[model samples]
Target: MVALRVGLALGTMAGAAQAEGVLPYRDADAVARGERLYEATCATCHGRDLQGEPDWQSRDAEGYLPAPPHDQTGHTWHHPDAVLLDIVRRGTAAVVGQGYQSRMPGYAGALTEAEMREVLAYIKSTWPDRVIAIHDRINVEAGG
Candidate 1:
């Protein structure tokens, strides 16, 4: 009985481990739709390739930064899933505290949660394997 229980526990854990982290939010069609939305709504400022304008790390005289890249070069992947989701839904000020102004717009009313998830999934799918692994670990540690 003990051995059977242990084996079952291990099997459950293994199954969970194999489950795709992106699966819940991953919808290729939705991602494709998000890609269009990203291009139309985000690409101009963020860049067609998701690379922000020059000196993305530096702030302009107005205190606004050029949008940063979404790929591995930037710190986007360093943030956990919830943080990213919130940023998309509520804008930077929601998480960055009061008086923080960002060129990034809040999508609270503009997008449904599924649409937000699709956008994020699309972004995640573009990341390098290493970045994805790090994000996966972050998600795991975050108890997601």
Candidate 2:
């Protein structure tokens, strides 16, 4: 995990404190578990290929944002680790701090914390290197 620590250090600027949102994408077992969880739990709305739903940027008739892609093309990487975890645990309505009604369900009490981390790691695994770099910057800015 030295490389993970190194990457995280660079992303968080070594001494700065931040919410640790980065998952261990390099962990073979974690990543594999995550892929399964994602396909079973997340792929429906996010798309089997992580492309998200069509017109994901637009609001529905109820003014809720559709499921956004988890791929580099989407804004999932724009968020830091804490936010992602919060969203997964609390669902979109709670995280958005708005009355928006997303179809996303909170997996709190359903998936273990490790499972969530694994799932996120799997998602990150799919991003290209440049996207991963951007995500690292996002972590830096988010203080994680």
Candidate 3:
């Protein structure tokens, strides 16, 4: 049973790695650029402190999802780095499927891949050490 669990975990890790490839950047400058871009593009709805808005988990009358918080308080970190990047580049609608609407904009034409990595880095940088460590474990398991 223990071995089975280990095998499953390793398999999951390998699959995730295969899917995500590698993170594009690891430097401070790229993270800084991402932070700037996030500030300009994402902060209004997500909040400067990453707290998100009140009732962020609840949808509005129009059926739009409330902008979720980027902090640990929300589920943002539950996603893998690759998934997050896709969401940023393609918009939440792309991931959630058509007929689903999201206020998030696709940064595909607006931001470079490196820029997307930077933004992601900036968001990760804000996380506490524990969360960061978890992310690192995820990266390691994913073959980063």
Candidate 4:
């Protein structure tokens, strides 16, 4: 089981590395661009305010959980940068396998690598300073 978990984690890391480019997410330009993309593409399900859907933790009648908020209130900050990039490029279902169903659509067809990074950067920018610091630590711990 440990080997299987490690294999899956490695697989996720490989996918994230493949999806992300050398673009710096902290760049103001990238963050700004990402904001626009988020407003246009992400706001629908995540909400314009990033509040996400109500009852996000519970599955609906169809067995699909609602989209969780991207803000500090949600678990988004718990994931490292690579995981975020992977989730955006591949969709939440790809990240959460084992028969988990996600409402998020993979943006690989619609978003460029830079765009995905930008979008995630934009989301991170919305997080509080403490959350950002924690997430940064998470990235560092992951050797990012």
What TM-scores do the predictions have?
0.81, 0.83, 0.77, 0.81
lDDT for each residue of candidate 1 in 58-118, tens digit (9 for 90 to 100): 9999998878888788888887777888888889876798688787888989988877777
Model 3: ten consecutive residues of lowest lDDT: 17-26
Quote model 4's TM-score: 0.81
Ranking by lDDT: 2, 4, 3, 1
Local accuracy of candidate 2 as per-residue lDDT tens digits, 21-102: 4687878999999999999999989999999999999998888788999998999888898889888988877788657688
Best by TM-score: 2
| lDDT: the better of candidates 1 and 3 | 3
The runs of at least 3 residues in candidate 4 whose Cα sits more than 4 Å from the true structure, single-residue gaps closed, are 1-25
Clashes of each: 0, 4, 2, 0
lDDT of 3 by residue, 26-103 (tens): 567877787788899889999988888889878899888888998889877767787788898999999889689889
Model 3 has an lDDT value of 0.79
On residues 49-90, what C-alpha lDDT tens digit does candidate 4 reach at each position? 889999999899999889899889999888887788888888
TM-score of 1: 0.81
Worst 10 residues of 2 by lDDT: 13-22
The whole-model lDDT of each prediction reads 0.77, 0.85, 0.79, 0.83
lDDT winner between candidates 1 and 2: 2
lDDT at position 9, candidate 2: 76
Where's the lowest-lDDT run of ten residues in candidate 1?
A: 17-26
